[model samples]
Target chain A: MSELLSITATGLTKRFGDVTAVNDLSLNIHCGEIYGFLGLNGAGKTTTIRMLLGMIRPNTGSVSLFGIKVQPSQSSIWQRVGYMVETPHAYPDLTVRENLEITRRLRQMSATDAVEKIIGELGLMPYANRRARTLSLGNAQRLGLAKALIHHPDLLLLDEPANALDPAGIVEIRNLLRGLAENSGVTIFISSHILSEVARLATRIGIVHEGRLLKELNANELAEQEEQRLAVDVNDTVAALSALGKAGIAARLDGKNSLIITDKPTMQHPDKVATLLVEAGCPPTRLVVEQRDLESYFLGLVGMKEEKKQ
Target chain B: MIASVKAPDNIISKLVPALWVELKKVQRSKTLWMTALAFSLLIIISGLFMYILKDPEQARRLGILGAKAQIFGGSANWPSFFNLVLLMVSLGGLIIFGFIFVWIFGREFGDKTVYDILSLPTPRVTVVIAKIITAAYWSLALILLVFVLMLGLGAMLQLPEWSAATVWNGLGLLLGTGSLTVLICIPFGLVASFTRGYLPAVGCIFLVIILGQVISQLGNGQYFPWTIPMLYSGAAEALIGKVTAPLGLISYILVGLVGAISLVFTCGWWRYADQT
Candidate 1:
């Protein structure tokens, strides 16, 4: 209900006969924030995006964009919203430029050069005259982004924007999105299955599993939750464990060849552990600090790994 | 602040851009050209049949005439040729015109581009209206193409019974049948929208055509929307006049009512139904 919120959905629920696609979902995204919606496939990410764009209606709740309630008949609010849902699809027979032109005209923009500008911005010039059916998946994705961005709207709801892009293309889009948020103040709600991609770009991340948001964390909080451990490769693992234990720093054997220590003090000061090991005549051969990646963190939060552990 | 900008009050103002977009999409697709060619081929083939009927002895000598040529009623004239064209439109128009409606609406779902247009700055109703209007214009274009081709081919074949009044009457019936056929095909757009693809709509068209034939043969052609157009085109008179009644005012009203209801249903579906 807050006017300042750029996107708001309250008690949003959608059920298809016996299946509930999205359940009691609520989200509030503010201006200029890159909100990452992270979920596995069939986790209702696309369904939520569809609801937000008014492509599908929620059975039990309301969605508002820019403080105005969303209805299928409403158009003025859409002028300020740009969205790319699921895989971007254009008329296969139409050229990339023609596809963009159709979107520009449908959006009712008077500027004739908007299509040209977006084509250039998205690096679609090389394939501008090519039919969409002929383009590779990467180029097709670029075309989809071009259509969504042609009007330069204030809000963007992208579903897997990096689905088929190369590493460089993904980085370019990341930088472009960063610039859009920083310079133009565009509020972005991007959904992705790639945890690292979202971790690197989002200011806030919401992890959804089984149609429910399991957690919402900011950048600093996510970084803090990353599990850190001190790994040491000693000439004698038993001696190293004994040395660390005698020093009151608990360490366990890992992989039958290395010692893993999650003890706060030992992780904070690996040099002290090295000295203790050396004093015990079990000098370390290799020592390094390792942190859990975003992928593992996401999987751990979703209990995907717990099933594996069990 | 950007959200506060008011949309245009006039429907036409909002409709123009959407219409332009729809036309552009139609122009880019091969469906229009393909349909036009199909109708042209129908006209030319009908002309060839007339040519064979023109002189049975010559046609038989040339091996072009078959025993079925008797269906031409042993005549090759403007009146018969025009009636043949009317029948063609009444029958072929259901598929051709229905295909146009199906592709125009169903391609969005097939190409998976429905999501792109569903949340655009233009109202969904405007988009639907624009598509309907485009389909109307496109169907007219096809009808016009058939009309012109039939005239030129008829002239080239130099069939008998050429008169201004006859030609005018023929043209009137052909056009009236074509218009009614186009009006009835609007419901296919609703089928396409509801079913969200081309196959189901095409199936619906075939079902209606078959059902129309069966119902018309049962002596209730005037009561069915699909049969009414063919009845108005004089198909019943040519085939089974004794059983079919004259098409009444209620029949035309029924056609109009079906069209209006389908259009309203399609618009309502776009406006209120969940589009997953």
Candidate 2:
């Protein structure tokens, strides 16, 4: 592994009995890069995260973090890495502060104010004295994040970080993570099933489907991958469809009675379609260029892969 | 020019913080207080029996107590009281101490918090060691508290035979039997770890208790880890007149080996086994 790489997993493969959980998985996450691992629910996201953290050893390959080999015995590497595998859980009987204190001690953080600072940063100050079992799901998730961040780790591996959070809490965590990456240069590997959530913060996104990386794209490249179309609304949808088809621009009516044009030429030139509709005596009521959102693109990729498998 | 060097990390420094974390979990949970309450109740019941045995004439007026007291061969002296306490400790310690061990190890799985500790600056083996140490001391503290309660109850009842030798011997037997019982409870930590829950481990404890009672009745109590403490405490002799000879060193060796193997296996499981 290169010295600049924070995480490197080469040809990693894990199998649970006959089921291959992760197959031929390889990653090279650089220092201070936010790598979003996008997958569906059972798409081997958590399994891959566990393998990265050395919670589960890969059957065929290996992982290294911060130039040190990732193994159960390598305790020093964890000093610079923080992670939350799945739904975060705490000792139900301990207060929020006490739970954080336990994590602080286990992480060997000597600073006295580390617990209080994290509690305040995660907006958990009100529930600091409250027992963990009594906190709401959002607050419990915050406590989990606080534990991971209390040590000021250089690399964070979060699986479904937005799980069990309200919209505002999600935005707050997003901003916090963005600030960490921008200011402190913390390298984060976040895995989530929601592409929209990951797309908003991830600088590099890896789309995984059925335990295989389908595609990897930079944040800017994601826009290029999205399928574009020109949706046209008119008083007579049938007339607009015929006009576009007669003009050799293959178009179909969508569920909402709008003409959907997937041809590149028509997508690039919506004004030409407007002129065609005007000449056809059904002036266009609406003509707008539309691009697929990140979520649909993700589903299309996964669905396309599934179809190929079948 | 001057040279600066960093100190090497030792196991003690690593264990201290993990041990502190484990002890904090033990202190904050209700299992400790509940087990103490259960042990106290057992002690109070032993005292009630001692009171009944002390006053058989007063018990004769009561129906069942009169009949039971007549058939009882043991008197209500300090020696008999100490014997009763030892027998109770040997039998009750298996259930209580076994529970403490399971709770300390298995609660991490039950509460779904095992993953957090698995990857940390502290190694997994260190975490296991800290838990085992906490469980050991916690079991010892509960045994000590019950022993003190028994002493106070004996004083209040004013049983005869107050020799210093008798007190010392009783204390020795209680501590020895309690220690042996705690030793056998170590394997339950392994059971809890591999099974990933408390139900199987708790069931295993009860199975061991039943088998220990039956096996002790069959005169092979010296070989069984669960029955060794009872045999050593002379409970087999006092309760059923079955065990006559004193336990040899082999019995203690067997208990120690069981504990050592269990500790090793627990640590190895945490280190090598896939936690998923």
Candidate 3:
């Protein structure tokens, strides 16, 4: 069962002198899957990524990339891995081509189709000779990603890969990442706070909070949980909401006369609602079911009340 | 989509990429090269002018014997312009080399690009080692270029003073001074790793330079820790023929013990820098 695991981190812990940035975190990422690691600000996502790259020594536990226990001194496993960490900086002086060549030499890659391959694939042929420093932010990010992609690793770990990208750049990155995973079966472990993008790109997701795992689920499951709410428009929303409650259904006021039915409402449940509304001197004018979004499902899990703050 | 990386055989090979990567970044910054070139040219031009003005007869001697001739001032007028050039360049090289080393490491943090550096295929230790060697290579290149340039400058200026002894003294001084700069770099580099900005590293280098001068003033100061690189060999200083026992003792203190210990600490302590 575990043979197919591309990355398996167990009981990983890292600390500064006084603060525990990541504590006893365990994660399993199967092969050929896009796993999103989600968390808010300063939630140890960056620290965990560093450990897997063997950039830091975890105070305890272990991290294995491609099934080999990653060691601080031993760097063999990196050959099969590609990574982009937070706020990545590129060689400002090097033209995009020179940057690619340097990475080529470091990896000891041969002079064969290597240059043409990366250039052709990353669509970087246009900016090949332009000095990296002069490229705009979106261009620089594309170049940074291009540099990372040159090695063609089986596993790609990208931290906020799309953070600095503009909308079009973000779409390009998502498409490219998806293409890589689909064509080459590369397992990607990505961490981001952008839930909508994560939903679109990830096949599986592991949500992290305060240096601990909150949940792990497939995109389908998280989405399924959101399709439960119904939106209703009516007059006398207070009477209507009470009408819904007395009818053994729950509804919340969205505005003066608008209500959202949070619980699933069958045909019989609506009859109970209508009867209660007549007794409370209020009747519904219109009703419609609203498709749920993962955001609300997430808020539900974390117990965030939807107070129409938006 | 990794296709560019070649797995290095061991720690040393891995370190090369890291060093190469950093050097590439340095090269990307035009200001870095501007500073290095300006420093080199300033030393070469100044040393050349002084050699020609001080000893006309020696300057008049156009012999490319590449030797140091004993002249009016023990160190300054040592026959060939090479020795004069070495002394001046060494002053600039010591600070520039150390500053470059510190900036290479310090800038990564100060600029907040350290994560990009360490996240490459190689480990952080390899990255640190790479920065060390990258700075060493540039510094060494600067030293050798000055040595060769001085020899050429002597001919072009048509100086009468020329000898093989001058070459020996110049090479000797460069080596000693270069070694000292390398040693100075280790501590400053350490300070760079911990600090918020590049200023701390630059500050420590200035402090070392100032303190070294004060110690030299206390007594015969042209030896060991004082001159660093060539202090042990006393080549150019030997041409000048002025290395006191205390100076030699300081040289030993710097090259033999202090430098080695600092390297060990940096390796043990800074090998796995958190880099934030």
Candidate 3 lDDT, A1-310, residue by residue in tens: 5549989999998889889888899998999999998877788898888888777788999998777888755555667777888766766667888877776656556455676677888778888899877887777777778767777888999989997788988998999999989999999999987677888999998877778878898988867765755566677787677766766776677776677776764433655555566777887776655566677656555556654422
Better of 1 and 3 by DockQ: 1
Best by DockQ: 1
Q: What level of docking quality does candidate 3 show? A: acceptable
Write candidate 1's Cα lDDT for A2-24 as tens digits.
55789999999888898888899
Q: Sorted on lDDT, highest at the top, how do the candidates line up?
A: 2, 1, 3
C-alpha local distance difference test of each model: 0.86, 0.86, 0.70
Candidate 2 DockQ category?
Answer: acceptable
TM-score head-to-head 1 vs 3, winner: 1
Writing each residue's lDDT as its tens digit, candidate 1 over B84-106 gives: 78778788888999999999999
The model with the greater lDDT, 1 or 2, is: 2
Interface RMSD, in order shown: 2.8, 5.6, 3.2
Per-prediction TM-score, please? 0.91, 0.92, 0.83
Ten contiguous residues minimizing lDDT sum, candidate 2 chain A: A301-310
lDDT of 2 by residue, B1-276 (tens): 001111228888889989999999989888989999989988887787778878877676676965664343357878877777787788889999999999999999999999999988788999999999999899889878987999999999998998889889888888888888888999999999999989999999999999987886677878898888888888546744554557798989999999999999999999999988
Off by over 4 Å in 2: A231-260, A268-289, A304-310, B1-8, B66-73
Instruction: Flag regions of model 1 displaced more than 4 Å.
Output: A1-3, A231-260, A268-289, A306-310, B1-6, B62-64, B236-243
Off by over 4 Å in 3: A231-246, A250-260, A266-275, A282-289, A303-310, B1-32, B48-86, B110-113, B117-127, B156-158, B220-250
C-alpha lDDT of residue B86 in model 2: 81
